[model samples]
Target: MVEKEGFAALVLRLRAEGISDLDLLTAVEQTPRSLFVPPQFAEQAYSSRSIPIECGAFIEGADLAVRLLANLHVKPGQRVLEIGTGSGFIAAVLGRISERVMSIDRYKMLIGAAQRRLDSLALRNVVLRQADGSNGLTGEGTFDRILATAAFPSMPRFLAEQLVSGGVLLAPLMTGEETCTMVRLTKTGSRFDREDLFEVPYLPLVPKVASFL
Candidate 1:
């Protein structure tokens, strides 16, 4: 269980890093990381760093995850798509702000575990699916915001198209000479402008199949 003091410490730490949104802080406080991580690592759930979970996968750095989510500016009743659901912790956070959330993961086991946990918490607004996230939640319609937890060599153009005008797409991209850079891509007329935030290490985004030219 995450006690108040521990949660407060986390908020303070994130505030030090320039995240001062009280709503974001409350979302972090309300979401239980213990429910996301494996049973053995529950004690370390509220810490700011990542921890190894089952199948050699790791939970995200709490601060980094929070920062990524901050970029979403999630509003009540907005539809959001999350790539690389991981332990579903971020999904849970988004659930607090959005009317509906669709999160995808390639690994079946991770989705299964996350589903059970989300059910236990009565988080019905979010859907977890086992699929290729790079596909950008096809048939789900355009989204108000799209967030990718995984870093890839390049941002998928489909994801860019999926974002509604005035919406934001946040992901970590591998730019030249940089292993990972968090990018904020906002759609304009015919092109999108990219703004880099900070360095991060995230799992690679799943590749998409293409038709032969």
Candidate 2:
């Protein structure tokens, strides 16, 4: 299992790899990955890999998650919405940066488990819910930033309505016949400016709250 020394090494490695946002890295460092990883995967908590959690969902590769968050550029005091709240690790880290984070998952069991993880960490700003998480968060009001862990066959243009004008949405979207890539959509006056960030491994967004755990 990775210990304190491994975490320090990870920060140093992230720096060495040109992830220049020290504040973001600090937040990542402060948020222990082990707390969110399932017991069987505890030893992989600090590795640069995706850790499986409850409900057959996964936390993306640690470095990949950081890259996406870096592109999202979540600022302090901003309201963030996270779709597919897998292990709740990203939301917890975002909670440290943003004023509040509303994370939703299709799997009810994932939400309950993730909420417990957030509570244990004393991260009260993050709220987890079992919802479709496709486009209906408007009830909670628009967010400054939105990020999705699941992939969509196309850019979820409908989400623009759920974003504050000028808000940014980060997601993994299908680019070709069978490939998925991470992209950022910036709201721009009734339109969106799309930026394809990089390729990422992600599952399709599944609608409906799972009835069974």
Candidate 3:
């Protein structure tokens, strides 16, 4: 009962802050942030703050996910491809609203942990995989929405190609030598129209799977 009230409070706060999407708010309210948070960071799970997870990675603040997903404009019956699955929090959110969610991460440890969380919630639409996040899941076919949790210097062509026509890709890119800012790209024919969202620091999308992790 307390948990329900806590999430309700969060949803109201986010709505007051202009995150008015009902689906997004409901997903946030229904999904237990604790499921994706480490036991040590459980207290911070529902806050708009990033918290450390396993494999030396940190899940982004819930506020960031709200902003990113708001711009991603995910909808029912859409397929989402998520790069850098991390704790699979975003992937789980995508799964709640989208038809299918294919999330990949370089660290097997992270994927394994995320799988457990998703399974606990019975989020069967979300498929967590341990693979090179930067590889773009070449043969996995196309997606209606593509979201990369990791940042890159620029939108990689390989990842962009996986999007179907009129699809949207949300990712953070290096705006300057060392400055990273997230952007939204909408695929139109052979080109994409870019829209700068906000600046947020993110780990670079590195190539190859972590055989050691």
Q: Give the top-scoring candidate (TM-score).
A: 3
Candidate 2 residues 76-149, lDDT tens each? Answer: 98999998888888999999999999988888778888888888889999988878876647679899999988
| Pairs that collide, model 3 | none
Clashing pairs in 2: none
Candidate 1 has an lDDT of 0.81
Q: lDDT tens string, model 3, 82-166?
A: 9899998898888999999999888888899999889888999999878877768878899999999888877777888899999
Q: Write the per-residue lDDT of candidate 1 for residues 1-213, one digit (tens) a residue.
A: 355666777788888888898887787778887788878877677777888766556888777788888877888879999988778889989998888999988777788888888898899999998777767788888998899877878877889899888788998887655478889988876579888888887766656521210
Question: Among these predicted structures, which one has the highest lDDT?
Answer: 3
Candidate 2 residue spans exceeding 4 A from truth: 209-213
The clash count for each model shown is 0, 0, 0
Q: How high is the lDDT of residue 12 in model 2?
A: 69
Which ranges of candidate 3 are over 4 A from the true structure?
Answer: none
TM-score of each: 0.91, 0.92, 0.94
Q: Pairing residues by index, what is the TM-score of model 1?
A: 0.91
For every candidate, C-alpha RMSD to the true structure in Å: 3.4, 1.8, 1.6
Ranking according to TM-score, highest score first: 3, 2, 1
Total backbone clashes of candidate 3, pairs 3 or more residues apart or in separate chains: 0
Select the stronger candidate by lDDT from 1 and 3: 3
